[model samples]
Each structure stands twice: as structure tokens, then as C-alpha cells.
Target: MRAFAAAAIGLTAAVALVLTVTAIGPPQDGTSPEPLLTTVPGPKK
Candidate 1:
């Protein structure tokens, strides 16, 4: 049925995504090299 086909497609996509991310693994460093902006800047004079 169409519902079954859709479910299979979703499952396959999810598995592929998990495998890809697993292979890539996490970053070596705990933190990022570039600093992340946390606050908005004030208006310039």
C-alpha cells in the first residue's frame, strides 16, 4: 500500500542519515575553534 511504501522510505532515510553521521563521528575538540555570538550588538554611534 501507499502507507507501507511511505513508511519504508522514511525508515531507509533515517537509517542512512544515522550511518552517515556515525561515520563522520563527533568533533575532535570539545569546543569549536571559532567563537559563537551569544548576545546582540548595540547600535553603533
Candidate 2:
């Protein structure tokens, strides 16, 4: 009985998480506008 209750609680939590994510939907801002890192020129040999 204890195992069954635990399994039920886990299943409920998983379903709730999936529903919440679906409701939130995708992000609107999209990708970053600038490059991740800047490059610097190397000293001449």
C-alpha cells in the first residue's frame, strides 16, 4: 500500500509538471543578439 501511494504521488507530480510547462509555452525573446565572446588581435611574431 505504501509503494502504491508513493507511485501515485510521483505520477501526479510528473503530470502536473508537464502541464505547467505546456501552459507556459516557448520563450518570445529568442536567441541572444550579441556574440558570446569577443576576440582580440594577437601580437605580431
Candidate 3:
């Protein structure tokens, strides 16, 4: 019974987490940024 209760609690927490993540709406700014790292140096090895 104890194990069952623990499993139930864990499952509930996981479901809640998934719901919270998905419920978070998109960014309001509507402006997507570009990558910060464009090029890499230090070669010829």
C-alpha cells in the first residue's frame, strides 16, 4: 500500500509538471533571436 501511494504521488507530480510546461504560452515579444556563436577559431591541428 505504501509503495502504491508513493507511485501515485510521483505520477501525479510528473503529470502536473508536463501540464505546467505545456501550459506556458509562447513568448510575447514575437521576435526570435539568432545564434550567439557564429564562428570558431584556433584550427590547423
lDDT of 1 at 21: 97
How many residue pairs clash (N, CA or C atoms closer than 3 angstroms) in each of the candidate models, in the order given?
0, 0, 0
After TM-score superposition, the amount by which residue 4's alpha carbon in candidate 3 deviates from its true location, in angstroms, is 0.1
Regions more than 4 Å wrong, model 1: 32-45
Put down candidate 1 lDDT per residue, 19-43, tens digits, no spaces: 9999999988788679888999889
* Candidate 3 or 2, higher lDDT: 2
Q: Give the TM-score of candidate 1.
A: 0.63
Q: Candidates 2 and 3: which is better by TM-score?
A: 2
Better of 1 and 3 by lDDT: 1
The C-alpha stretches of model 3 lying farther than 4 A from their native spots are 26-43
Candidate 3 has which clashing residue pairs, if any? Answer: none
- lDDT by residue for model 3 (8-31), tens: 999999999999988996677876
Once all C-alphas are superposed, what RMSD does model 2 give against the true structure?
Answer: 5.4
Q: Please name the candidate that would achieve the greatest lDDT relative to the true structure.
A: 1
Candidate 2 vs. true structure, TM-score: 0.63
